[model samples]
Structure formats: structure tokens, C-alpha cells
Target: MSFQNTASFPGAGIPEQVSFDRKELSVILSLYGRMVAAGEWRDYGISSLRECAVFSVFRRTAEHPLYRIEKRPKLRNRQGQYSVVGIDGQILKRGHDLKTVLRVLERKLIRAVD
Candidate 1:
């Protein structure tokens, strides 16, 4: 009997586990870089899961994350794909355009130096 190839073949390259794209990453990193230099963020983590992709920012490696940038492709048509969540699990913003949604974080960067 001839052997049939299964869908989960060993040599098959698995698709991406997460949804965030290059343009999304550029926006996230752009803000992250500034926060890093400003001493507001010290570390970060990336998680690509079946449901969503997340970029978590932290003030320290061992502490809880300060913020999370998530891409939920499933929500693209309804609420949009990009979202920024706070440490308390509150959604700070959500939108189709990454740049616009990220503006909230930029606002945090502004301050008055006395």
C-alpha cells in the first residue's frame, strides 16, 4: 500500500503563530525606542499566540508589564486589529490604523520640565 502524506508533515514549515505585521512592528518599536531612552521602559517581550500577538513593555525584567500592544486579526473587520492595553487589562485604544492608535502612547511622552 502507498503511504499518504498527512497535513502535519514534519518538513512542512508552520505558518505564523501571531498576527502583527512589519508596519505594526515599526510603529510599536518607534514608540518603544523613545520610552527606553526616556527611562520609562527597560525591557520588553513578544508573544505570538493563536488568538493574538502581543508586545509587552516593562520597566524591569522581573516585574509585571507596564503595557501591551496587541494585534487581534479576528477583530479586524469589527473593531480593528491594533490595540494598546494597560497593565490593568484596560484597553487604552483600538483602531485600524496603527499610527493613530499609537498616538495615545506618544501623549504619555509629553511632559513639562520645570
Candidate 2:
């Protein structure tokens, strides 16, 4: 019995996990910082999955996220890779540009101030 070694190849048995890049995180964090200062958001979470990456914003630590920012590379060509989902699982915005997609949340921040 002979067994072939697969150790030579990196990520041979590893599943790919999608995540936000530095630039992407920069933009997201900028908004998060503003929200935090405004007292609109208090907690956040990040998740990296095989198909997509998610950044969840929470009003409180124990409750469900108020919004979810998702990056699905597979949708890059079809409906754009970036999307913002509301608490009720509705897509608020979707586009190729992260900043543009995140503008939906910014609008809420504006409303909170007034």
C-alpha cells in the first residue's frame, strides 16, 4: 500500500475563508467609529465563511445585530460583491463599491442625530 503525501502543497486540505481586507476594514471601521461616537452602535462582530465575509453591528452586546455588512465575491460580477443587510434580513444596498454600499447605514446615523 502506497500513500501520496500532500504536505508539499499549501492549503491542500484547508477550506478557504473569506474576510475583509485592510482597506475594506478601514472604511468599515471609520463608519463604526462614527456610529460609536454617536451612541448608535455599541458592539460588533466579524465572521469569515467559505462563501462570504460578514461584519455585524449591534446596538447592545446580547441582542441580534442591527445590520450586517457582507462581502460575497461570487456576486462581484452579477449584483456586485458588497451588500448591507438590515436586521430583518432585507438587503438595503448592494454594489461594487464598499463605501457606496455602506452609505445606507450612514443615513441612519444622520437620522439619529436629528
Candidate 3:
């Protein structure tokens, strides 16, 4: 007697995974560390969504995010690939250079002390 082979089913659509590169993470974490030391930030969260990836900073666990660092690969060809959104949902800065994009938040850190 011969054995029969099982049939294959339809393929499922897999969602694209979003992630931050080493250099990108380095730039983000550098700012985050400074904010933490300044006491302006206490907690942080990261999200990898379909269209973009976000790094959220919070002053408190239960409160809204104080800042959001976002990376949208689609925008790389246009305005930029990196963006910083304020708590009010406004785009504080956007540019191709991660360091330049993060300058907006750094300004806040400066005036926060002076």
C-alpha cells in the first residue's frame, strides 16, 4: 500500500515588521539618557507599526507621552525619514539627519534648566 501526500493551503499575508537601525537607536537613546538625567523624562516606550516606528517618552507612567520620536521610511524620499512630535501632536522637527531632527527636543532641555 502507498501513502498519500497532504495538500497545501492558501498562503497568509504577513505584516511587515518595522525596526530601528543601530545608528538610529544610538541617537535616540542618547537623547533619552540626557532627558532621564534631567528628570524631564521617567519612562519610555517603543512601537513598531505598519507605516512607522515610534519612540515615546513619558514624564510619568500614567500620563501622556511628553515627546514622540518617529521614523517613517516612506517619508525618506520627501521631507525626511525622521520626525519629532510634541505632546500636543505637533511636528516639532523633521529632517534627514537624526541629530538635526533631535535638536528641537534638545532646545527644550536647555531652556528647562535656564
Give the residue spans of candidate 3 off by over 4 A: 1-15, 111-114
By the TM-score metric, which is better: model 1 or model 2? 2
> What digit string (tens of lDDT, one per residue) describes model 1 on residues 1-114?
999877786736755587667977887888999999888999999999977999999999998898898988889999998899999999999999888988988987899999
Let me know the TM-score candidate 3 reaches against the reference structure: 0.82
What are the Cα lDDT values of the candidates?
Answer: 0.88, 0.94, 0.89
Winner on lDDT between 2 and 3 is 2
TM-score, one value per model: 0.83, 0.85, 0.82
RMSD of 2: 4.7
Error of 1 at 21 (Å): 2.2
- Any runs in candidate 2 off by more than 4 Å, and if so which? 1-15, 111-114
Q: After superposition, how far is residue 95 of candidate 2 from its true place, in Å?
A: 0.4
lDDT of 3: 0.89
**Largest TM-score belongs to which candidate?**
2
Positional deviation of residue 65's Cα in model 3 after best superposition, in angstroms? 0.7
